[model samples]
Target: MKVVKRLIGQRCLGIEINARGELMGLQVLVDKKDNVVLGEELTGMNEIQAFLDEHPLTPIALSVSSDEIIYSRTDQQLDDQSMSDLLRQEVPSFDPEDFLICYLDGFYGFARKEAISEHTSALSAYADQVVLLGFGPIPAYNLALTLREETSDRLTVGSYQFDLNDTDVQEITPQDLEVGGLTVAAHQVPAFLVAIGYFQGGLGMMGYPFAKNDENLWYGMLLNKLWKPVLFSILALLMVNSALFLHFNSLNQELNEQSVLMQNLSDRRATLASYIEQNRQIARLGERESAFAIISDQIGATVPAAVTMEQLVLSPQSADRRAESAYQKEKVLLQGITTDLKAFSLWVNRLEGMPWVSRVASQKLTETNGVTRFELALIRHVEES
Candidate 1:
């Protein structure tokens, strides 16, 4: 309610006839811009386009000269029946069809239909969606809602303020509110605020299409004419959303199919890996068996005549490993019991000295009741160089 009651004015486009009664310039008041452009500048539609270029899609209130309109306040707050009777008695010259009549209960505004049509047609050429078309200087009494001798309704233009009503009831002068530049001057702001009370100023308007029949209620500006476009917009939005949903659903299905295919490929890869490991083990065992015979003959030649050996064993160092040769590497194990520790040491040193031996160590070395029981292993050497 405060939004309506505050007497605010937005961008207003004012039109008027010249002194010669020819279609004249347009006065543009945009957002109370203090730098108001006046006569001769808006000679054509150029000014209107220029204003719109700067302030696009701004709501425009049209203010015409007050001489073009007839405004009055009745003695009593008239009902429709009383209003018709009063209008008939007061203004018998007015034909309802020749003129457009717009009124609140007490305040009324009327203009000739032919003249308004001409003004509107010219305005429609220059602008769009003209919301409020009224006489420029609006009545303060209408907004105040009462006529008091002490109270006054005044509208300021360039250097002067005009009286909307003579003594009691008032109407705003329809002088175009002029706003010139992008930056409005501070002193020129007050007049625009006053014009606000008149533009969408809650006064009854003759030509404005979307004004309320009774008051400035929110729904008053929205006529029954607006329903079809709003309905079509909603329907169009729903259709777009449905199309997008179908598209994304198909994409999701494709993604799921690709995911399943990937999982199958991963399982196949694991099976192939296991098969390769089994082949590696079989190849390593073949190499170990083939090398066992050669290693046994070499062990027989290396052993001293003084030592006896048992539990002779030879095996490849890694069964699961792949090798380029049948006799890649092997570990040799031998056991013996000897009374001479010095002779055992000499034999161990000889085993280490062999080029095939990587390392030599005893797995078990035990002496009991003057006899020594021992084990030794010689691992095959592998050098990159």
Candidate 2:
């Protein structure tokens, strides 16, 4: 014999299979997130499997029975008569006692508004969560209140009201709020906000089934799958980037310190050079002053009383050791004339033999009517006596 499963309303639907893999029954669940079901049916399993294979159902947990499969659809576009017809066609030969049927028509137009409302009210007694999905303003809004009132303390209803006139879904009201109970907190807004946010940004919404019994896929399964790894990777990259930035900053600081040190060294070198040049200039000036003083003293000491100098000139020569030794000694040239030749010759001998003087040379003596004229060159020792 073929097994059967049946489900009622737009809640989550599931099938329960026996140990032999034969279909036992079907459960129509109200709470999709928690895996809570409203009602179930038992019928032929083989026929239900064949029907499901032909018209694929959304993947969800199921509660199977002896001979039936139970399920529900939230898409309100399916009309009541059409839904009834489809169920008949799907389970062609099912016993009335073995079949249970229910549906949610919140998304349907105003034509099936009464029928959908009646069905929702009837199912609220047993269902754990009832969802009202719709586009219009009036019927959808009305259904929201009705689900809340009917479910009361027993069940929670999530009203997903899509505004057909407006391009976006304006507001989502949780079922727990309308019944004066503790609603899902605002922190839970992120997941719902993200889903709606994507819809607003032009990405369509895709539903994934989550089972309450299965701990892994329960809370924000779809969101966790997509965002957890990505968030972790980004955090890790930011940490690595921060470390690298700090390393480069340290290196730059070190380079700046080295640059300052080099500049300081260069400044010290330039200062030393300036000091050396100044010292050389001071030494040269001192030597020049000493030489002038010595020459003045010698000229005074060698002057004779009868030989008055007519003109005296002193000129300095280059101090080249090699040239001075090879040729003649460098001296200061003194040009002059005197009235007496003998007196001038005596003065020349005294100037040549002076202690500070190295040597003295004279041009040939010339006497013109008792006026003796001659030039004398005196070489002074550069070293101290």
Candidate 3:
């Protein structure tokens, strides 16, 4: 409640009409703690209005002289709505609506609405709202509560003195007013304390009933206090959401870029694999060609001049009737005509001496015409030979 009062920035402009018919005004701005922001003995309507203009947009608490108000005490418990009904039941001669009613303690004070409007309408132009619109010493009741350290049930200021109660106040004569307890001369009672009471009363610290329309002002002040922080919180949430969205969007874009890079790397790896396979095939073909060249050179160097070579085949297909042509082995087949069989026999023995030739077999030997025709098969060792 104290925080709410501070947030609404509730201030009070307490004006009292003195015995001399001069307008005495005091302005007080309330916070978590009580502070008399401005205190001046304002006289005349122009001075009051100017004083009020100095602190614009503050609630006003006007206190008229006791003579202007009709005071009554109610024995029964009453509410704001029933105050007028109670006044009408008590004073049936006049209309209850014609007066602005204020109930404090057990007493109800009724001031003519026209009389209050005449003085307040002009002053109201300078104030934001009206907190209290009736009674002279009403504000002093709250002032006594505020000054708890000062044990005074009565307050005297200016020419008039008022007896203060827990929820009531009564104007008394100078002789009837008590000794120096909480007395302030020079119209100081209503000047400072009344302004402070306006704040307290409006804040619901004291149960003094104000004008009914001031309820709207109270609600408006509450709304004014609440909406600023709510709006700021909404804006803060929006900023956080926007920041998160931007952060996630940045990460998403980076992920997409990484995916594309990964795909490009994958394609490059596949191309490298294909190149390695082609290089392996080329290496195998080169090895086979080198092996064939070495075997042909060894065969040419071991040949005999007495034997005429007609045909020579390495790793020949088998010619056996039982075996298919698909079967082949590491063997050399030679068909030739030799004029001297003795030279052939000597050449065969030399061929068997070679490391590559395991054995040489003579398959056929026949005298055809004047040349001796022979067919030989040379078997090679298991490996490349």
Better of 2 and 3 by TM-score: 3
**Please, what is the whole-model Cα lDDT of each candidate in the order they appear?**
0.54, 0.43, 0.62
Which clashing pairs does model 3 show?
none
- Among these predictions, the greatest lDDT belongs to 3
In terms of lDDT, the poorest run of 10 residues in model 2 is 1-10
Candidate 1 residue-wise lDDT, 174-197, digit = tens: 333343223323232223333343
Question: Candidate 2's residue-wise lDDT over 30-98, tens digit each?
Answer: 232333233434345554445344433322332211222233333344544665555556666633333
Rank list by TM-score: 3, 1, 2
Per-residue lDDT tens digits for candidate 3, residues 120-185, read 555656444666654655555444434535666565533434454433444555232222333344
Top-scoring candidate (TM-score): 3
Flag regions of model 3 displaced more than 4 Å: 6-10, 17-22, 30-55, 66-68, 74-78, 93-97, 141-185, 202-269, 289-385
User: Model 1 — which ten-residue stretch has the worst lDDT?
Assistant: 32-41
Compared with the true structure, the alpha-carbon lDDT of candidate 2 equals 0.43
Better of 2 and 3 by lDDT: 3
lDDT (C-alpha) at residue 140 in model 1? 28
